[model samples]
Target: MKRIPQCDNTLGPLDFSKMHTVLVDVDVFNCGAGPIPQDGRDVWHNDFVKMPFSLSSYMKTGYTKQTNTVRWEVIYKQLRSLSKKTTASVKDLEDAIIKYNPKYKGQWSFDALSSLVKADPNGSNYSPKLFQKIAELALRLPELVKKAVPLLKRGHPAAITLSQTQIACLLANAFFCTYPHRNFSGPKAEYHNYPSINFTSLFGNASSRKKQKLRAIMHYFQEVTAKKLTGLVTFERRCLKETDLPNWRSSNKKMHKLHVASYGTIENEGKGMLQVDFASSWIGGGVLGSGLVQEEILFIINPELIVSRLFTEKLGDKECLIVTGSQQFSNYSGFGDTFEWKDPHEERLNRDEWARLQRQIVAIDALPFKHRSEQYNMNDVTRELNKAYCGFKGHQSNEPDIATGNWGCGAFNGDKQLKAVIQLMAAAQAKRGLAFFTFEDESLKQGLQQTYHLLVTERTTVDKLYSLLQNYCATQQAYGSAHVDLFELIRINFSPSKSLL
Candidate 1:
């Protein structure tokens, strides 16, 4: 029988004209992500989809596939050990590798492992098994590591470089590919946003145009080889200053750094004015109740202690500032107002207890200001300041002689407001260093104890939120790119002084 070519209108060896256009649709259920056949359910006919392929496809296919089961198990075990706060050393890496496969324990010499990679005669070829694992694990490991270590300081040299190394290592290990060379200006390389690697150079040989394009794309974006790693070193170098990185325990008096952040009040009257008098009108006692006196209290009590804090090796150097700002206060009474002539109760707070409570209140005076002045120092400031006294402007003829509840009993209002402020201050202080007990008064002590826990809890929540936003933006590619929006996910870490204040 002779084979005949098909014609438009006649059925022969092949004919489409007589075939009916039937839209055979099948809803793909738990099958992995792949191109749908005309009939759809021929999924089993195709090779099983990759783990990530299946997971990503689930959003569209409504598939609940048990993909990544083995990979995740391995990754989770590695991460569980890696999550320790202690610095990861070469020993740790060696230990992990030894455990990964016992057969390689004695044979895995560092130089031997390094030399195992061969120059491909046909260009940089990668093992199929390695490439698949690298691409799959790359998407998941960072997320897990981020959870275990929430704060990654870019200023730390090791920290700044670690992200790039991790990305490169994961990809290389998975693909069994030679690590990309580091030559920033090479022809085949293009730098992206990463600031950790010194210079990444990706290479491609005589492959098909599409393959070359894929290689370029992978190196430029997916792989860590096409990013500027040394840019971070430049950034850190630019940030260094005289006040940063000093020996704290040094006996040299001239080099002794003062780290205080506060304002100077020359007037003796405001020295013991007490922060309780500064609560705003909403609290009725105004300035006295507002924890607005924090800065003043720190200065009056001991300025040097605060100054010593900011002048540390870890903190980048910044100029000291002298603040001259208004410190609001609420007026309780004057010469014409009634004054208490005697004690109201037989059981009175002892002098020591009263002093202790007063100290606690004073310690909290700087809380509000800390919220705003974190990046700079405010201590050297000589604030020619004034007090805003809040109360009723005029008196009515029908009004009772005694102050109304709306006006707020000055003493009670002052105490409550002071308590809230001190609580915040104590909590902030605790985060910076070991905190001291200042609440000696029974009443103030109770208030401090109750509010302290609340403030601490709130601080933790806010820190987490800020970190999430910061990390998101840092990890994600800049807007208008094909990369994941991982950078935008980070929350900004708040400076204890500025945001809270």
Candidate 2:
């Protein structure tokens, strides 16, 4: 890490060129091997009908040999009738969904939805009206998917651009359970890797947590259908080949620029920078089910991102999803069970060359360790290194640095010190800087800064850091009763009195 001279608080930004600097050798990083070869079978063919969202496409629907049996006329007529109503009851919505998805009539549950409406702050006043609006919007799914490019799973670069209105329409369909063959589960299930696109999960297994989530989701529908959103959003899935992976064990790059803060969130403080979403491979994670953490919080506030679940397959370790131009439609307070929908947000960000919003978020799911000890193995460490590197590696030199913090540290129970070092090394290998938000963890802020300073002073290479991790892991196992602190282990190994002095 190169340090530039600073100016007074009242002065303008510091001039970096004028500052004294130490040059260190830069190492080229590579991940061994290329992406795994796929069989001739296409993953999309296993799950999707390859049907585009269009009125004509749905108009001719009949019982085909396909798993999903949707009668387009039946759906259109039911939605059309619901659209005419100023208010709709829970039973009416259930009947409409059953009309289209007769297969799950008895199996499906709506306890959560019923609870939500009953627990509504405004009582029946909002539930009936909101259900009516969602039903009406869902009727327009044909129009929404009319131009939606099919996101095939062919391991190639592709993007789907759609408006907020289009997203709302699709979500409304999700609410009505219009998507067929999506309700089953098993190793042989067609859409196993994909998160449940239908709202069935949210409506079943009623609990206080479910009620709160419905509030946020219902609020999202209320806003979108109330006004047609005017911006375009694009979801791009980027797959990295073995040629693109870095040789992590031999990287010679020093740490890049870093900014650590004890306060402020990645979304607010790291604006204009590429934000990292600590996600589950299944995309929305347990959001629809019963899990909420950093990833779920992000999806709830920027609900448009949830639509990605419809097309995105489970992310491979070498792959990540880059969402651009998705607008924030609502503001919220708290996390998990405490979460609440606050107010409608007005997005003013400018669009980019692709007509997408300037906002960019990269979704990378870290390995969820059931036991803390499971993450200390070398193979596990390498997997995480590759995962973070895959997301942090930049395609263009001009791309903004990453804005991330406590990536897998929350519910995933990751060690913050280990994750921070992994991200630092990955970012360094990619020649990009980082803006890490400690999420108000003061101790982590100071510990990371001190450890980073020591590594820089030692001119430590990534290989050296990796070697140190090996020793630390061994020590942790040997001393089974107590866990070793990573920064402390490094300090003891490279003490100034023993080495630098």
Candidate 3:
């Protein structure tokens, strides 16, 4: 047998201070002009924005049960009134938001905003003047959406392309809580399946965590409002048909390139490659709620993605969101509860044929297990294989290898070994290499290398591994304590001396 190429397994922590930082100072209005070429309309989805929320749609002066009372004219007046001020207090911003969301007057808190201001009296992140600037930018929401295309919930594949500056305008509106009827959640709610879009949650919760979140968001507004964003970004929601799915248990493909590392995040280390966002089926997960993990961290760093919440519907098992060219506005430190905004990141990736950046990200939500044993069910296993394959499969032959690690293992409580195998199988079928980031798990790095070496040496096909998993799962179900490690199971069944000989 030929020697298989060893996977890259280097490990280390990301150094944020080393990242390049650029000064933001572009003419936002001039750049907002439609960069769409004459053929740009051809790529737009026909039935996009099934439920359109135009600038004029929610505008109303008097209160009505059916329509929003927070009129656009009223919002414009309040924001415009504050535009001339050199600085505005947290109370000033809160008052403006309350005027629009009268229903949540007493319910909402602004302790976080107050704390941010107190934390750094002289810091630009909490500057009172910056609040006024963002408020001024938020007022431009009317103009930004004036000629903007609707992003409808169509049954077929569709895409929406817009400039980063235009996205900033929409996000500014989100920051001010302008989108009506988006705060609620339930089965019958209009956007029940979507993550929350409003920034009210981040503003109210006064804590070390919320303060860090505020820093990231504030930095995003400062950059967009100050500079002329110069690139295009596309949000594509792909729905995979049953025919498109690979038959995992019957596959004959060998393992693609494998890299196991214990340090560095997929985003920084995997640059120029296809990155995976461990997302919720609903997309952003609890980004606007309280859930912060891999998915939330990705969104906060690239705030432009948050706009997808305005229109993207919940994804099915065979579906995924491929975001191309979204810009990263801020640098962040820590993970989950300890996440904090560090500094700015200047994106330097070359542009693609579509005028977007070369960066590509696929969002694939993993199954959340109530009990660890529930994941052992073959039905669930197959579902995960299909989901990962749906995201890893390349639309173009030139697509880069996938960069992922411990997907669905964190908040979802998935077993890392099982998920690693699942992703490897899916990537093999897709014919793409895998760069797995164990995120400082040294044991995983060594175990994965040994297990993969065995699989390569014995020429173990996907079907054979699938069968092995079946027995392992059965044993797990029948005798819980008799549960065997995956690598150990493979060793016992196909020891190198016996299986290879």
Candidate 4:
């Protein structure tokens, strides 16, 4: 199917050179970081994050009583045993992981893993050798990533760049649930601020979603172990400083160029553009859980992105995560309940100078509302706008445009036209263009095109649009539970001449 993108831009593709990445121009790999030093944040042996090789003394495992046996020793003994095997059953893998992580022995379930192994659609491609290969990779955690990974904690802006080999190693560790002190949660917990790192959550609660998710995840391990993967992936958590947050009520910036269409997806049509991940505040959302939404599905296809769950903390409304160079491993056929792992994705995207895949994704969670009326308030409106702006803001000159559509509109209950305007305002504020995919909603595609045409035709600026939203909010309040279409409001107010859309 040919994608006929609705082109509002009269110009051709702009040169994407000279765009700044989170990494510095230096080849140091960890370049361009703020307070963080040349070596990445090393919190090994600390309570914040317990690495596989952290000394038993540092980890303070109670087992140190007998001739100084540490936690990692027991972990490696079990993992080493698994690695020696040419093949293993799902039950064998579960038993090995339980030997190290005995705390969750009864708490966790491997029904999902077993189910995948039994009915895995990949047939021979998904075999027990893949599990043994994963164990071999998991045992190399201490070597593949020497630098201590700092948690992309809330509010602190930082970036981590690691080779795909390094990513594979870390994910391999995650697959085995080897990382310590990360399983706990809540206010008093050490890694309470971070997302779940272990694959324990994924292995439980057997369902169709988990089966499909495992297919993609297992495919990733198969590919990484089958070949010596090259390239790098960088995860940068961007925070909107109080000074950086735009005063939407005062700004006069006009709408940027928009290419709207009903077909294509952010990953396809928005390639080479800053792709948007309609994320949850807790980062990867429900990818580890039963969720199979847009965000979860995105993480499923690009399993490397799932690695961010290991170190990234919950995202604040003012913060967003920009991932560069992560490779996509599988193709899928549907969204949500209908999602199925189609096949392996031939990752042909060009690599950047840093040897990272050129693909970039921004994770920004929107305000989830129980009722659509909750979003009309100016305070919530400003929060969503600022959130998108934090992700859309340019780090350097000649940055690529944003590729997104219907963000926060599906399960979050966001009004389509309103979110569209909010994103348009953010892109304009960030000085980038936008490519919006309506995902086959012809009504939304037609409505959005008409509304955008009116906004552009009237030469409306961001500040002016913001003020109009305020008016619409008030009108919505006065009208009570009755819903109002934002495009209708914009058209009625801006289209004084009754221009045909």
Q: What TM-score does model 1 achieve against the real structure?
A: 0.16
Off by over 4 Å in 2: 1-70, 121-128, 152-155
- In candidate 3, which residue ranges exceed 4 Å CA deviation? 1-70, 147-149, 152-155, 497-501
lDDT of 4 by residue, 1-501 (tens): 111122122222111122222222233442422111123333554323457777742333456565545667877888888878867888888998887777777899999988888886348348767888998898887666555665677887877766678788889989998887777888898877778879989998999989989999988989999997757678888898899999999998988888899999999778878899999988888999899999999999998998888878889989999998889989989988899999899977876555677788999999999998888889999999999999989876457778999999999999888899999999889878889999999999898888888888888889988998999999888888998889888888789575544
Full ranking by TM-score:
4, 3, 2, 1
Off by over 4 Å in 1: 1-71, 83-86, 112-501
Error of 1 at 364 (Å): 73
Top-TM-score structure, candidate number: 4
Candidate 1 structure quality by residue, lDDT tens digits, 1-501: 000011112212211111111111112211322112223121211111112112122211224455323333343354346434244433444454344333445644332122222322123322223333333344443331231111112133211111222333333333221111211324444321111121111121212222222222222222233332210000011122334422212312111111111222212222211222122212111111111232322221221112111111121122111111111111111111221111111212111110111111111011123221121121211010001000111012221110111011122222222222322222222222112123223443343344344335334442333234334334432442343321121112333443566
Task: For candidate 3, write residues 9-51 as lDDT tens digits.
Answer: 2212211121111111123313544342211121123333321
Taken over the whole model, the C-alpha lDDT of each candidate is 0.23, 0.72, 0.74, 0.81
RMSD of each: 31.6, 10.5, 7.5, 5.6
Give model 3 RMSD, 1 decimal.
7.5
Model 4, position 243, has a per-residue lDDT of 93
Off-target runs (Cα >4 Å) in candidate 4 are 1-42, 45-48, 56-68, 121-125, 498-501
Which of candidates 3 and 4 reaches a greater lDDT? 4
Question: Candidate 1 — worst ten consecutive residues by lDDT sum?
Answer: 381-390
Cα error, residue 369 of model 2, in Å, equals: 1.1
